[model samples]
Target: MINLKEIKNDLPAGIVVFLVAVPLCLGIAMASGAPLFSGIIAGIVGGIVVTLISGSQLGVSGPAAGLAVIVLQAIQGLGSYEVFLSAVVLAGAIQLALGFLKAGSIGYYFPTSVIKGMLSGIGVIIILKQIPHAFGYDSNYEGDVHFVQPSGGTTFSELFNAFNYITPGAILISGLSLAILIFWDQVLTKKHKVFQVIQGPLVVVVLGIVLNVVFANGFPQFALAASQLVELPVASSLNGFVQQFTLPDFSRVFTYDVLFLAGTIAIVASLETLLCLEATDKLDPYKRISPANKELVAQGVGNMVSGMIGGLPLTQVIVRSSANIQSGGRTKLSALIHGLLILCCVLLVPQVLNMIPLSSLAAILIVVGYKLAKPALFLGMYRSGWNQFLPFVVTVIAIVLTDLLTGIGIGMAVAIVNILRNNYKVSHYLYKDEKSITRDKYRMLLAEQISFLNKGNILQTLRKVPENVDLEIDLSKSAYIDPDVRELIEDFKETAVTKNINLTIKEIDRTTAPTDEKALL
Candidate 1:
């Protein structure tokens, strides 16, 4: 439900998110080699359409930096933007099918360590990527997550390069903007409700603009060029805005290339959405869990609408969603309002928005990054134990070295190995007990849900049992023993009889595990 009471908070948050999202949408589109306006169309659809159907309160969906490379290649390979849009439409259909099939449970498999690592890695990336922009180097595009830059330098190299091409105006604006945001977030917000009503991001943006105008008059050497400021494309009239919408060419929708691209899109987009949904829910101050399947449905519908109007493929983006949460968005209304604000700004005041400095936006993102990758998070995880801490560290390192999905894959691999190692040693308990049939007898108790992985230990223990002695094998506590283990036990029954051993098998509840009775049957 949309709560009118929180609109005061949501309205201010929406404006802040809109301020951050504009250049991102444009920069992502530019990086993908698509029309810049297409990114805005996606931001609009993702915010308004997705939020209405989505169960996630704080998650904001839009064009993701993760998808930018795929989009860049797919458009060229598919021949044109119109045909790529057709593939995006089909991908949405595939996502809708996945939601109905309950594929959203994939979110559950991401271990807590890996999830924390993913967020921390992304946070580190935000600070690293934006440092260049903050210091007046705009060679790289906004929202670029890759280590190898599309602008021709590595992540660290770009930072080093910033020293040579420093624009004094951008540095001054970003530094002051950072300080103002810190003061607003730390001091002013605690002291009064009025500060909460008057948001820091809004103030930083206004201050940035005023400073740039002052630089132009008083210190021309320190003034920023047009490239260092917000660059929204202005439309001449309503007709021009209407002309921005481009429909997909349905004729090529059935082609093999389009179908293949659609399948790829469906898989990548769904994975990214699930990752962000989990991360966003963790960031929610209320600790509310979003319905993953419902979120998938929302994203599918959003993508379908975006493609119908010629926008880039969309996903649940962590950057904007984190920005929303840190800026104090309480409900889905903040996402809706952010979309409306973007739509209104693009239509009404593109010229005015173009005056906002990118340095100010960079400062805002830098702060969001700090909140995500705090030092305390590392200390807390380290104290949790090595099993949890190792995977978390590996995931963070992997994400910093590679991209989001690649890093997650590495972390999950490490986590799964830890589980397998633990499972290998503790499959069953074999010991002499008072409940044994006689003084010479031994008892073998199976563990619950034993898999083929546990067969080695079971085999070694069974071989050590003396043939002339009585033995009792208990299945009462076990559930769903693997067929291989069952077959081994059956072979042992014959061996026991040959060696004149008295063997007793205890029955388990038939309803809970009928498979255990297959050895006797």
Candidate 2:
């Protein structure tokens, strides 16, 4: 049975995410050089449309920041945004194919260390990119590239520029919103159950909107222009709005550029969705497992709807999912509600939403960035072991130095190098006591397929046997014997003879192992 308590509980978080998503949807579309409404439409479709089909309870789908670079490049390369939309539709179809094939198990192939590295890298990137915006620098874009110059020199230069030319209204709203968000948590921490359940961010967003309304009388608080707000395409009637939908250019569906674009979208979007699902599952208090294949299908449907309506590509975004989980979401219903909220706002309250200060949203993202890239996160990764630590640090450094995909690739390479250096291979060993060895002295068993790295441990364990102990070494189970282990065993046997230790050797030659045995290995 569906639990109404769980649905009601998600309202606070869902509303907070809605506030957070508003400016982000607009900003991401602006950064991608797409129509501003496209991002909002994507968010709505991702939330409402995808939620119906998704197996993930907490995951919230929306336009992704990672796709901004690709979308921008596709538009430029295709010489038209409409052509890019055609590619998006084809990409959606491809994603559908991937879902039906149940290809999500591929996500499991990523080592835990690599996935942790990726999460930390994204966290660091979020913090770095949002710094300027938090300080009232909306000149460039919200999710700007790490190294790319923003018409200025560097990221720091643009940040410095914002401080020099700060807008008072933005500064006021940002400071107020940040203070409210921070202090709300502190107060809630001290309060009893009822207040604790009420999230501070939700209150801050509602207050921010209300404050804008109260101060709208000839005040600069409502001064955000169309450039800062989500700009919906104006139509004469509801029918005209429906008529504004984009259709795929089937003529070029199989063109080389379209195919490449489709592949790019499918691959990257799949990675992001899977990663978000894994992370969200880790974050789930109840430890719920999301179905990856179903998620892909849901996202495919969302993207198909988005692309057809001039919206950006969609994915299961960690940012919204984290907020959803933190806010107390227990099922997909919260996502559906949030999407309806976006649609309602777009249809009825676009004017009032236009007054929301960019700096206020920046402040919200700043807090989110802090939560993701906190000092605790670094310390936690450090404690997880060098296998995890190296990749986590490398991913963060690479992303901060380059971009997302490039950084992930470098981290994966580093992880593979570590795996190779450690000689990660499987082996099995069996010990036996033969009648001859029992009548004699010491006996030791060695298995085939043993690599050189296991030499020290295996040798040390065998060396503890007493001189009179009988030993029977069996190699029948081994399929391959490394020269190193063979030499070590030979030396040990010679030493056993001098010590009066009984040594019996048996060899088993087989081309392949038994099926059950192979599975154990």
Candidate 3:
């Protein structure tokens, strides 16, 4: 049920995603040491194949930067790129199994604060990664997300080096492109439908080409080198294009090592896809939730196809999805069209695409990054209180200092601590009744869930009961109680008799209390 009417917006958004995805696909592939065409294959399959199968309307998938290191290490360990592809194929099958088995429900366990932090952290990373490209330093590939670079410098060091190798041409293109994009998105699109249809990014990509031509002819100093532009593996003929597709070595697919690698890939790829899918849903303006299990099936199929015909492992990528959302994409049609556009343009006129300056794309991405990590988002999170704000800020900082997965793990830990701390108060009601004070009586009402985590607070409350007092421990509201909690209550019952305090345990769900004491009232 593709909404044909939304094509007006989808078509333009598709074009924008295509523009943003091109170098990323190539860069991620190159970073992973896989053939450049493999990345394109993954991108095309993920966009077209996964879009048709996935329930996510706004999510876009392709070769993920997160998997670059894994792919690189796996390829080296497996002894060949073909062998690694076999693992990718098996990995996809495992993902399909996971989807059917409903393992995707793991996504629901992620706290909201952590998810928000992931989005903001990624947004921060995008800005940091692209700043060098925006400043005309193309030494770091566009898809490199790691803080420690394989190219021999840290993220900050790259930024420092970018300034030294500053290209006047890159500066002009990125600076002007950013200005025009801001004007187009903020002003022009609002003013006219024609401006809306003709997106700011597309305009700047074209402008970059035209400007580079002008620089080459009249101002050589301002002309970017081939290194500073989009680099695609130009396939001259149908045969040449066909030559890029590499088949996996199926002979080793069933081996122990290969199977182990496949399982690892399945777990990592599925986790990354689930995370990105979660993040993408948060960014969607329609507030529509994508079916997570079905999304796993789609990603599984995409990876299988990618591995079958020479492509890196793919996942639901947040950066491209964010780009699509920001570009007004309303349906999967945008992703499908982006795939079609990549296939057609790469086969037909790759050289023309190669002309579009990296600086221009950098500008577009930097703006997207800014939108995700907006200052207002920080203020809003802060107002949400320490529970939400701490994780959000920690996620952003950790992501910048480390990488995506590590940062998320750290944020999740922080979020869980906050949850437990809040639970300490609300898990049980420990208030002394005013009416009971005169009679040396007290009441404690338990929460619906009384886990072992609630034991500490409940113990303190229990110890506060004085000698010669009547205390009522109410478990009527409790649906579940940890054994540790029950034991604690049992221990308290013994002490109550020694202190000459009358104790009553009401509404216990258990059929039998300890044989030593009839504690239940």
Candidate 4:
């Protein structure tokens, strides 16, 4: 299934994603208060191991920003990084069990409105979070996506605070990088095949490094602080590099606290993975759907391996996945190649990676963010009617105000309310022919699926049947009828007789029909 022609595209895309992912892995590890190398290890496992087993061609997995708070607290709560690794292993096992149990179908229940809201909300968050980095205020961790900043400021407050601490060199580099990215996307890519092969982000990264070097040597006033640059852990020798990999302390794996932590990680990580998978599938240009259960299994295995080697928890990350798709990755090969590239870089040229400035990467993400939450997207959603637009806007706002899961829960709640409201009014249709007006004859057709939510509506409809009217209730097309609904219909049979209304039922199961008036009483 690995096409050679696709590799031609995947190769460059892999490198582009690799460029975007390096600092993120480091920054997330830093944010989580774990060894910096663990993030890279997780990235490597996600790219190489997960992609091999995963059914998603476009979804790239890695250390998730959303899990950073949990990871930070888990490590602190569990006493040490080694013990946390054991919990991670257990989490992976739990995910594997979930996959086998066919729990992935839970993702299908997410309405399209909520999914779009997630994507747009994340997009807005990315732009907001990256602005400070783009301006060279590295007070916050690079890959942290939460609305509340670790520095005790909100996302917008951080942006305002960043203005006072701007580094001229970072701004200049980011400005040029953004311009080049725009040029590459809008101009060079359309005009030249060579530009397509060599991505704009790559060029921006190279230019950023060169610019920073120039600033450091000749223009000290314009130079970025150490915090504004990528900080990959450097190993002087092969032994030092090998020493970076840590193994989990399986002795504590079965401890009650560790087991509890594992279950928490498993549920949160799985939910994030499923949400990201849905968003990524929507972003896929080919419109290919990834198998959610297969993805859970792949993530489980990836996390197991990552934990064995002292890596952070893994999930299908939207940022990296979106970068891969935007850069033209056509298969899982791009993810695999990116993983291998990260492994190779950390071993061979981490010094070189550390030279790339954070501003350039911020610019890349800013562009990616724009693509996800465009003004046109909001306008288009607004045109879809209030039912759709309310959930979409509510989701975006909730995500911006809270975390990913909470925002999604809010959006889903709104969507469910909309469904219930529509269902309440339209559970059944009452039709009467003009010729039957004198007789008050009515034909009632039940909805395909009727639940307790329809009970009140059905009762209202039944009560409106005028005295001496003829009524027919049809259930031929209904696949399911709630117990309450069935009971109401059966009770109505007796009421119909009292009112002198002729009642006939079609396709109603005889077992659910009243056998005697005593049964109804």
Candidate 5:
């Protein structure tokens, strides 16, 4: 079904994604407190295995920063990384079961306002997290996304800290790298054929490596520290590379604690994967909708394979997916190519990857973050209405203050409140026409589905009926009315005579309904 022209477009994008992924994988592994090579292995498996099986064309999968804290705690609880790998295998099995059960529709329950809030919040977090890296302050690991640092600093405080410890060499490289990215995105891609074949991020990475080398040999004053570069473990030989892959300790596989941890990982990873799937589909220029259940299957299989090869758990990652979309990737071929590129880099030339400066990649991510959380997006959401703007802003603030899942929960709670408020007001309408000779003509029209939520509204309307008024309660179109509502209606009928009100109930089958006074009571 794929055409060669699509492949041509995806090739360049794939390289760019690979370039962006390298440091992220390394940084996520470090943050997870796992062996650094495990992240690389997961990236490879996510790219090759998940991409092949995924219904998504643009989504890229790998170890996510969202799972860093969970992974770290899990490793500590299990007492060994090998035991955690076993839990990952169990999690994959659980995900496979979830896929077969068709649990993917759970993603639909998330409100659009909350989802948009999540995207923008993540964008803000990305920008905040990468600022220190841009300034060459490597106090935190590369892929750390938490608002509060493990080193006891808040996101805002880190910015101030970064300013105090700014490295001139890193700043210079980052500035030039950002300029090149902007030029490539805005001008070069449109003006030249070569720019279409080569992405700006790739160029920035190459130039960064060359610039760092120049500073190291000729201009020592501008030389960057070792911490400012990508840090992939250098394998000396074939056996050394083979040793990087670890086997899970299956002895602890069935332990109660292990099973519990496995279940937790499965639930969290599945939720994250589904969220990213929705976000990626929204970002796709083609407006392609990926099958959420099928994505779970792909992720499950990917995690199984990754576990067997000592890799971190895999999920659909928004950062890489957004990068793929922005870089003009047309098919899953880009994801596949990026995975192969990671494999090739690990096997052939890790030194070249290490030559890449962290600042350049941070520049690329800063641009990506800007696209997600642009000022225009905030203004547009605000203009929509308070209902949309409130959740959107709350989500952004919550995500920036907490983690991704927690922020989304806060946003969803706010959205649910808005829904309840609207429901309370709009469930029914009581009005009288101005032309009516009898001013006490009250017509109450019930909503299509009236549950307990509309109970108080119906009661209030009944209480407000003036003396000698002709009240008409309409439920002709209502398909389902709750028992409590029916009882209330019956009670109102009994009280109607006391108020001297003439009440007419439409579409009521009193004979078929329960007439027991106890039932009404």
Candidate 6:
């Protein structure tokens, strides 16, 4: 069952995903206020351990940006990163329960517009948050959630500070990386056979690292120091490394605060993973539907491993998954390879990785951000109609102004309103207007379920019936009806004589009806 063809097809995609993953893994961990190595550890576990268990052929799991705020807050609130890791481990167990309970289908209930909006919103957030980091401003982390700066400054002002305080080394490396990334597809893509095999991002990363070394000696100008690098936890042995992993302090498990936080993390992470899975599936040329419950289980496993080994919880990240798809990944093999690469790099080449400029990573993220929030994406959403545009725009605005959860809430609200607006329609009818019973009117009748919204139209029509006019209020075909509408009908039936209607109520269970026939006519 191990498909070599699938593995072969995934090589190109694997390489690109590696380029994208390396910087992001570090950035997200940095954002979480956790050790930078924690992210790399999560990535390795997600790619290698989770991939083996996941039902998805193409999904790539790792520490999620959506959880950055949660992780950071949890670390502070819990008073220790180790305590938060305990929560993460517990969260994984909860996710496992959800998987077994078949809760993954809940994702289907969310409208496509809301999901698209979420992706677009996250894209905007990534770009906005990364700007300062790209410019080499280390004053704040890369994933601040609030629209305003931590010290009450605006995004622009904070960005201005970064620009004014710009490190020359950061600017050069980031600028060069971005330039190469921007034109990689246009220039290097057209090169001869061997050069063409290498992707633009890979070349750019390699060049950035090389340039970093060349300028490392006398020109400390180009070299970012160890302070700027990913700090691995102080582990002198494998046992110590394993010991650095955390478990949730079960003493806090029963607390309302801890439960609320756990629920929040579980719900949000599940939704995000589902959305990423959907997007990745869409990108798959083979159009594979990843068994979502299985994905939940795999993510749970990854998070358990991550939490046990001093890492952040995992989700099927859209950026990494998208990169995986774009890179032509055909199987989980690419994920496995990417994970192995992270582990190998960590074990063997931490010194080399520490030299990577934050700017270069920023450049890579900027490119990814542009791809997600491109003007074309906005226009495409607009053309898709208000159903898509309204929620998408709301999500983008709310996220930019607030945070991820707030934006998602706004977008979901818009999506629900749209669904109700589009689905429920009403019209009035009179005793003599049987001719009006066309397809449009019949649609309301045949609707398997009716809500209170249909009551007004039904009441108005019943009131206009001529004296002694025959009427049939049919429920035989209706699968369900709301109590408000039922009560209104009952009241109208009791007084039908005044409206001059001889009405027949069909298919209502006699046992469910009152003994007073007049009360229900």
Candidate 3 structure quality by residue, lDDT tens digits, 1-521: 56789999999999999999999999999989899989999989998999999999999999999889889899988889999999999999999999999999999888888888888888888888888887789998887778988666898998899889899999999999999999998899889999988899999999988999999999999999999999999987999999999999998889998999899889988998999999999999999999999999999999999999989999999999999999999999999999999988888989888998999999999988989999999999999998889988998888888888888889889988888888888877765677864567788899989899999999998887889878889998787889999999999989999999888888965655444355442
Error of 5 at 233 (Å): 0.8
For residues 1-521, could you state the per-residue lDDT of candidate 6 as single tens digits? 23566655566667677656766777678778887778878888988999899988888888887798788898888787776776777778888888999989877776777777766776777677678877778666544556765577876677778778777777787788888876776576666544445666666667777776777866877677664444444456677666645554567676676667767777788878887887677667888888889888888877777887788878998778766765557788888878877777666666666656666667767777777777888999999988789988998888778776678788889888877775454322233444644321211132457787777666675665556555667676565788887898789777867755666676767666557756667
What are the models' TM-scores? 0.93, 0.81, 0.96, 0.95, 0.95, 0.83
Off by over 4 Å in 3: 508-521
Candidates ranked, most accurate by TM-score first: 3, 5, 4, 1, 6, 2
Question: Can you tell me which runs of candidate 6 are displaced by over 4 Å?
Answer: 31-33, 142-149, 187-196, 216-264, 426-446, 460-477, 494-496, 501-521
Best-fitting candidate, scored by TM-score: 3
Per-residue lDDT over 80-168 for candidate 5, one digit per residue giving the tens place of the 0 to 100 score: 99999999998998998899899998988887788888889988988998889889997887767788888788888998999988888
Scanning candidate 2 in windows of ten residues, the lowest lDDT window is 424-433
Which should have the higher TM-score, number 1 or number 3?
A: 3
Q: How accurate is candidate 4 locally (lDDT)?
A: 0.91
Writing each residue's lDDT as its tens digit, candidate 4 over 279-341 gives 999999899999999999999999999999989999999989999999999998899999999
Taking all chains together, the TM-score of candidate 3 against the true structure is 0.96
Ten-residue stretch with the least lDDT total in model 3: 512-521
Candidates 1 and 4 compared: the better one by lDDT is 4
Give candidates' CA RMSD values in order. Answer: 3.4, 5.3, 3.9, 4.4, 4.3, 5.9
- Model 2 ranges with Cα > 4 A deviation: 1-3, 149-153, 193-198, 210-240, 424-521
Judged by lDDT against the true structure, how good is candidate 6?
Answer: 0.73
Name the weakest run of 10 consecutive residues (lDDT summed) in model 6.
437-446
